[model samples]
Target: MTSLTLAGIRKRFGKVDVIRGVDLRVADGEFVVFVGPSGCGKSTLLRMIAGLEDISEGELRIGDRIVNEVQPAKRGVAMVFQSYALYPHLTVRDNMGFGLKVRGVPPHERRQRVEAAAATLKLDALLQRFPRELSGGQRQRVAIGRAIVGEPDVFLFDEPLSNLDAELRVHMRSEIASLHKRLGNTMIYVTHDQIEAMTLADKIVVLRDGQVEQVGTPRQLYERPGNLFVAQFIGSPKMNILPIEAVAGKLPGQPKTASLVGVRPEDLELTEPGSGFVDARILISEYTGASSLLHVQLPSGQVFLVAHDGEAPPADTSVGLAVEPGRLHFFADSGRRAD
Candidate 1:
């Protein structure tokens, strides 16, 4: 296992600055995830660590060695891509062993290692099946098995389940989480899916544009985001953003401007029209399998979502939304978090 450190890492393409001075330290055997919207440079930063992309500035160290100039193959990192990247004609056994074969390992040793990885990934029964013959989850398992066979210091996954169907993606996510537990190796995953990030990561780095917005554990990022971007980005149904003037009380810090309040859907409690923080008209109610989501419009014409029970609030129902102060997030006009 290895720890990864990236300091002031920056990358650009001609006029477009992709990654802007990202500083991060990933501990040994930690599962770190980089999560952000598309074009936020999460994947580019991962590529830089893999030696697939050059670091325009700053240093990248694997364990104690500075490896900014190391070749991709020599970096002791294996990346599993979203596309699976499996050979259509190769059986699962051959695909898993191909890397070992190319590295000039003996056939018997290669077979042993391949079988071991297959057993761990539960792909033993599908060893002779071609990629075309396997399900999406099975194919992804094959891809992971290929990476596991390399016994690399770090495993990099770039949205490996994005191509799979919804159910398969969920199954594959558990498979990956379990695989990490069994291997206990350092891993870095990149995805725009916040659910995956929240579920898989021991630590999460939230990026916006090209900068690091916040880095913390799943609970920290969820419970206490550092800025407006992070508060809004990390949650599933997205946090409710209310205008500063809508709420009456002043926050702890006296600031240059009034603060906008953010509350997660789960933090909101619907109450009688006059009992809660603000009165809003419920515009729409959507019932998801687990819970209901209410889209409400405040008196100031600002709209935000709130989590509700599957019971609809009645069409055009007016309700008061109350939130616990401990669950509240305050952001200044500049979009930075306010204490």
Candidate 2:
């Protein structure tokens, strides 16, 4: 296993800067995920780490070596792309062993490595099958097995589960997590899916518009986001952003500089009308089996979501909502989180 370090990393295309001054480190055997929305440079940064893109200005070190000028193959890293990228005519065994074969590894060693990887990925039975004969999940496993056979120092994944169906994505997420535990290689994954980041990563690097937003563990980012962008971007149903005036009277001793307040959907609880922090009328209630999502419109005309377990209040019914003072996240006009 190897650690990775990026110092003042930057990427530019012509005059446009796509990745701006990123510095991060991955510990040995750490699972680090790069997560953000589209056009946010997450993939660009990953490509740079893989030596697939030129780093305009920065230092990239894998293990003890500076590899900014190293070729992709010599960098000792393997990449699993969103697409399986398997050869149609090649069986799983050949596809997984292809890299080793090209490097002139002995036939016996290649077979042993391929079989070991196949067993690890639970693809032993499917090794003789071609890509067209495999299920989506099986094909994805083959792709990962190919990377494993290379015995790379670092494993890079670029949204590898995006092509699978919803159920398969979930299954593959577990599979990948298990693989990480078993191999214990330093892995870097890029995905727009925050759920995947939360579940799979030992550390998450959140990016937005070519810059780093925040870096933390899943719990840290969710519980104490660094800024408004991260607070809103990292949560499901997104945190509700409301003008400070809406809750100024309800929250005493709040910072005077706070211009916006954020409350997560799960943090908002329905209360008796006129008794809670804010009053809103229910606009719609979406029943999602385990819980109901209430879309409530505040007096300020902003709508926020409340997660409720009991039956939801009917539309047009006025209800009061409250969140613990400690749970409320305050932000200034500049979108920075206020202490």
Candidate 3:
């Protein structure tokens, strides 16, 4: 019953506002992620929950207890930092049990908890190794193991995989996902990577400039974004935005107030000119093994991206871009999503 509730949470550094009126709920055993570009206050919000940062306003509840003034150790939350903050002089076993020792847990019980966590993280073979002797991924696992031994009610991860190589990051993502399944603890992870947000989170909170842009599952955000900013932010190649006039009289049942239209690169297909809604000339084609992304320029000088799975056409080739009527996204003049 470690559900969390944050109501109108705010943070301020002197007169500067860093987090503004954020309200969120996290169910027990849920994997929630906070994602945004750098300096968007995602990490700051996480710190507030961890008791490392003071909350300037509103209430924060963890299982019916308000913890605004609670010390971090008493908050029943464990944080796995990005830097793998392990002791230089201590081995893995000692590092994992150091907190318990400080809190006056009996040495035998501390050893039991440390051994249990080490086995869970498959660090038994490296128990005697120092942080310097372990690889980056192994050190990260040790950090996670250290947190696990605390038996926290909530787990917080702050870009734990940002330092790993691409291959190792992918592997760590897998390991973290499996860890969540096995532990079933309420976890909040922060990252700037949308792919990680999509793959890892049960629900995602998208932030921008210290504000939450939207909150939804990955498919919900991708298929029905709340506004212009989210539509472009959640996708890989990003949803392409075009002036509504470009789609004039093309889409059926288009919203009357729509000032812009969005089409995903994968949704636009190549067709013979005059047969499709958009007539454009290919300027560049990028091949990335599975597909080629074609950049095309319209007569109005607007460049649009289209992805093709079959053989890619050469550069300078003229092509028509076709999109299904239902596949189009309309946005109002205020940048909000429109029907």
Model 3 agreement with the true structure over 98-121: per-residue lDDT tens digits? 999999999999999999999999
Q: Considering only N, C-alpha and C atoms within 3 Å, which residue pairs clash in candidate 1? A: none
**Candidate 1 vs. true structure, TM-score:** 0.96
Q: What is the full ranking by lDDT, best candidate first?
A: 3, 2, 1
Please identify which of the two predictions, 1 or 3, would achieve the higher TM-score against the true structure. Answer: 3
lDDT for residue 326 in candidate 2, whole number 0-100: 86
Tens digits of per-residue lDDT, candidate 2, 1-339, equal 999999999999999999999989999999999999999999999999899999999999999999999999999999999999999999999999999999999999999999999999999999999999999999999999999999999999999999899999999999999999999999999999999999999999999989999999999999999899999999898999888886777875588889988899999999988888889999999999999999999988889899998888889999999888889888899999886
lDDT of 1 at 8: 92
RMSD of each: 1.8, 0.8, 0.9
TM-score (C-alpha) between model 3 and the true structure: 0.98
TM-score per model over all chains? 0.96, 0.99, 0.98
Alpha carbon lDDT of each predicted model: 0.90, 0.94, 0.94
Q: How accurate is candidate 2 locally (lDDT)?
A: 0.94
